[model samples]
Target: MQNERATDTQAALGTDTAPAGIYIHVPFCRAKCPYCDFYSVTDSDRIPNFVDALLKELKRRRGRVPSADTVYFGGGTPSILTPGQIERILGAVHDAFNMMPDSEVTLEVNPGTVSLDSLHGFRNAGINRLNIGLQSTNDRTLGFLGRIHTAEQARNTYRWARQAGFDNVGLDLIYGIPGQSREAWRAELADVTRLKSEHLSCYTLTLEPGTPLADRVNQGRIPSPDEAVVGDLFVFTCKWLDDHGYRQYEISNFARQDPGKGIDLRSRHNRKYWNFVPYLGFGPAAHSFLDQCRWWNHRNLAAYLADVAAGRLPVAEKERLTRDQQLIEAIYLGLRQTDGIDTVDFRQRFAIDFFDYFRKAMVPLIDGGLIQLASRRVRLTAQGMRLLEHVADVFIQALE
Candidate 1:
């Protein structure tokens, strides 16, 4: 049933036909999450300048990309930008790139930063998809996570999106927090699922180094999330979501299948990142990848602005992946999704037999029931999904 459901999801998404994607990183935020390490600033004063620089950067990269089928506005909080600003940026995107008529345009929004009117404005401004950052439905958990919005506020945000005429909406949730219980986490999922969101991104909270949460954990102010408990929660989440009519396409993402409604809620832009499809990113701290080369812009907003003003790309550094590096990435990224890697495609791309090349690594993993090799493809077993990092390490070591 698991494999069949996963296969059905891959067919519905048709990721193979998605040519490319464009990502616009909005670096402005009202406040930062204590557990987040993504580059973002609390200064709204710099937004106007940032918008101008972003446009310049977009213009400078015209004709350097393929016709894009998806555009994603990701951020510290893209909702902080007015609807007018979002529309202006999107207009530039349409003019500069060969945007598909049916391209999926998504905007990441946080509760408390937007209203029903704003959401309506966003819908009219070409944002066909909405991903709300509602990390928890529990008020106490919201406070512990340093979220600016309350539980009621998050509920209102979802309600407003629907009222604003957004048919495809996704919700983001975090689990495995310090001191959180299994029953509590289950209750959180039950609460959000009852809202009937078209998509869900349930991520296990990570205590990233240098973040406030990590500092507290290191100082013994709070205990780190129990690995065993976290693992159990991960397994439970997959099963719970599966039984709830949501398909797990990627490790952290699930989408509802509604053929009757013609809604495949999988995130097209994000699929590019997992499948190695080419993409171009604009704005401070954005990353781009194409034809085996990956590059990123300056993380410092000042440097990015200055570079764009001087008619130069704000690229900080870039590298072309070697064959070995590409192979490693292929294995690592492929295993993270349900579809896994196509052995035949891998062989054709690299001119090496997949089984012969990774015999040592494949044997033990298959023996241990961590992975399965069948139907000319490789994929993780349900048990293997929870230990994804460790499984990837086994493959990485074989390459070494």
Candidate 2:
């Protein structure tokens, strides 16, 4: 079943739609993953100071933003904090902002750090959703990725999370690991699908520059998967989930469809990002966007803490997007999901016909089988999703 929430295109283009959200970044980890590049440090000693600073930041930013319908606690492992710490942060948010009664509150949990009691306590503390990092069910793969949890621990974590009363749980999985075979990918996908979580994020592993994994690949410690193999696996992954009854929403996101219950479990907080909804971000290295202005916090924890201690907004840099830049972002982001682009909405929002304006870019993409044009919407074909990076490049250059 399609999700009940309006597509980002409709909401952004439609009048009287104000989507505001809150994102809290927990920048601490027990140990940094070899593949992780997000601004997290392996220092838990300073969490108390960070939490105090965060609440102050929240209070300080009051009145500058609107009430939010969604709040997400993501990080280096939000589960690492005590339930009380989490509750305090959520409490500060409620005290400072006009949070909706049924706000979708999510907390990102890692397999090794959470327990049944803690999960239940988190629920009691007001988190209604859990996003667990279960990248693979293969112990070998887990080890390769520097994960502290075993395959069994990951499964147990899911069971415990369910028992702790989280109906909207999301499972994060990764494919396209170096030396990963189709059989391995199949096994991983099967392991997760059987768990029946409300949402699944099947992402292809990328060796982002400067990460340990990328450095290893550069030095021949491991061979990067062949591009063709990754491509075939991506197709297989999409078809496999679709065949299993998960609704593919964004490229990496799929919502479960339980015919018995008739529920659509798409992520509300995440939908805001692709939908161009406004959001406020706190803690070090987090980003916020609103009113065409996009800003990010300090990337270094020391800098972040110092600024908050001194009553500063810790923002490192911000930009106000021009109308032309917004147009470019719309095309790139619109094509990243199954919803594609709504031409009519685009015309209305930007006061220009997408087809007439982007004729040169759209026609070749349409002819090349990379994009499909409909009466009201234009979307990427299955082939296009596989080659999206290249397709995005074409659109980016079209702006030039």
For candidate 2, what is the TM-score?
A: 0.94
TM-score of each: 0.94, 0.94
Q: Tell me the tens digit of each residue's lDDT in model 1 across 283-400.
A: 9899998767789999989999999999999999999766666667788899999988888877656665778868888888999889998888999988889889989999878766
* Prediction-by-prediction clash tally: 0, 0
Candidate 1, clashing residue pairs?
A: none
- Which pairs clash inside model 2? none
The digit string of per-residue lDDT tens for model 2 on 1-400 reads: 1122333343344322465889999999988888888889888999999999999999998855656889999988889999999999999998988888989999999999988999999999999999999999999999999998999999999999999999889999888988889998998888889988999999888888999989999999899868999999988998999999898988889998888886668999998787677889999999998876789999999999999999899999999766666677788889998999888877777666667767798778889999998778888888899999888878767666
Q: Best lDDT goes to which candidate?
A: 1
